[model samples]
Target: MKITHYCLSALLLFAVAGCDRLEQDMLSVPDDTTLDRYGLDTLKLGDKRAEVGKQLDALLDKPMQCTPGKTGLGDKRKAYLLEECSGVPVAGEVGKLWGEKLSFFKAVFVEDQLCSLELQLKTSGDYAALYEAHGKKIINLFGKPDEANAKGVRWQREGDEAVLKDLGDGNISFEIRNKKVVQALHHKG
Candidate 1:
C-alpha cells in the first residue's frame, strides 16, 4: 500500500530503550542499553527501549518507516542523526547532496516483519530545494525507497523491504518496531 505524509507522522517516535529483538542482532545490547547510550537518569513508563520499540512497531506496520531530517519548509531547520543517513540523495552518506546544502531535522526508523529499514521525512524547502527535488533517490539508497513523483505530494522511496515517506510537513521522527512500513488506510488527511 502507498504511504502518505499524514500517516507517516502519526508513527514518528523517539527510541529510548532496548527491546529483546535486538538480542538477535549484533547491535542489540542489554535492557539498559538506551540508558548507556543516551544516559537516562530516570526511566518513565514509556521510557523503556524495548517497550518503545514495541509500541512503535504497531505504529509503523506498513508504508515502512522513514527518517527524514533537516527541512526548509516555510522557514525552519531540523536534523535527524539516524534518519539523516537516508535523505542524502547519493545512495549513501548524509552531509551535502552535491551542489545542494541542507540541515537535518530528526531521525526515525520504520521497520517491517523482516526487519527491513525505511526512513521518513517531512520537508518544505532547502538550500537548493535539493530535498524539494531529489530526496527519494537519496533515501532509495538507504533501504527500500519509493519516489512519490506526484506534484504537491513530495517524495517517497521503497527499498527491498523498507520505505521512506515524505509527508511534506516539517518534522521527522523514527521509532523501533517489530515490523516495518505500516500500511496506509486513507490518502487525504
Candidate 2:
C-alpha cells in the first residue's frame, strides 16, 4: 500500500507539471493586451485589490444580491465553495489554481465603484476565525490579480459583479470573495 501511494504521488506530480505547461498555453490564448485589460498579473496583486471597508459597503448596498447564477456543479462543489466562500463574491467557485473542484481558493473580490479583488484560502473549523486570520489581510492588500499568469484578478467597476469562468481546462477563474458568498451565479459549468 505504501509503495502504491508513493507511485501514485509521483504520477500526480508529473501530471501537475504537464498540466502547468498546458495552462501556460491556455493563458497565452489571451494576449498581453487582453490580459492587461483583465488585470491578471500572476506575479503580484497590484494596487487595485479590494478593501474590507469597501466590501462592507458592497454587502450593505441597498439592492438585492445573491450568487447570481446556478448552483452546485455537484453536491461536492456546492459544499466546497460554501465552506470557503460564504458572503462576499456574488459568484461562488472553489478549487486550486488548476481549477479542480476540491475546496481551494487564492483570490477574492468586493463590488463597488472600485470592484476590488483579492486572494483567499480555504479554512477549517470556524468561519469567523478564518476571516480574521486571512480575510483581513486580503482586504488590506487592496489590489487586483495578474491575468497574464492565469491568476483571476479581473479589475473593478461599480456594479461590475464578479463571475467564475472555467476555460474548459484544469485552469479556472477562482472567485475570491471579501466576505461570505451571500449569492452566486446559477449555471452549470
Candidate 3:
C-alpha cells in the first residue's frame, strides 16, 4: 500500500510539471513571419497618412495621383490611388505578366490614416485561374485564410487583414487593411 501511494504521488507530480511547460509554450508569442509582416511596403496598419504618404513619395519620387475622397460605395471612407507605382508584390505567372499587361492599384485611407491598400489585375483570358492560383499562393505565404467563400478569401493576424476577391468579368482585387477598419465596414453593413 505504501509503494502504491508513492507511485501515484510521483505520477501526479510529473503530470503537473508537464502541464505547466505546455501552457508556457502555448502562451509565448510567435516570431515576425506571420501577418505582422504582411503589409504593403512600409505602409502598415495604424500608420498616419502623412507618414505613409512620405514613404510613398520616397518610393515613387513623386506625389500621389489623387486626393483621398469618399467612394459612396457604402464604406463611407476616403481613398487615394497610387498609380504606376512599384507597389504591391504579385504572385505566380500572373505577377510576371502584370505590369507588362494591365495593372492598377490604390491605397485606401480613413481619417488621414492608411487603413487599406488594394491591387487589381485586368485581363481577358485565364482570370479565374490566375485568381485561384494567387489565392493559393497567399495561403502559402501567410498561412490559411481566416475566412473563405466563393466571393473571396481573407487572412488576418493581430488585427491586420488581407483579402483576395474575384470581381467577376476577368478582374481580381487584393486588399489588406487594419482589422478595426474592416470591423467598422462590416458593422456599417
Query: Could you tell me every candidate's TM-score relative to the true structure?
Result: 0.21, 0.22, 0.47
The 10 consecutive residues of candidate 2 with the worst lDDT sum are 7-16
- How do the residues 37-151 of candidate 2 rate in per-residue lDDT, one tens digit apiece? 2222232222233333333233321221233223343234552221112233333433222122223222332231112233233323232333233322322232222222222
Cα lDDT for residue 153, candidate 1? 22
For model 1, where is the 10-residue window of minimal lDDT?
Answer: 36-45
Q: lDDT for each of the candidates?
A: 0.27, 0.29, 0.48
lDDT of 3 at 126: 56
What's model 1's lDDT at 33?
A: 20
lDDT of 1 by residue, 1-189 (tens): 233432222211111112222122213322322222121112111233343444333333222235433322222243212222223333322332133322231223322122222333433333124342443333322221123232222212221222233334433322222221223211111
Ranked by lDDT, the better of candidates 1 and 2 is: 2
User: Which sections of candidate 1 miss by over 4 Å?
Assistant: 1-114, 122-124, 132-147, 151-159, 171-189
- Expressed as tens digits, the lDDT of each residue in 1-189 for candidate 3 is 232232211221111123333233324424336445456544576687778776654433234465434332335464433212234433422232223232545666666667776666565535334433332334344454456555666667876777766676656666776766545553211
Q: Determine the backbone clash count of candidate 2.
A: 36
Ranking of models by lDDT: 3, 2, 1
lDDT of 3: 0.48
Angstrom error of the Cα, residue 126, model 2: value is 25
Clashes of each: 51, 36, 0
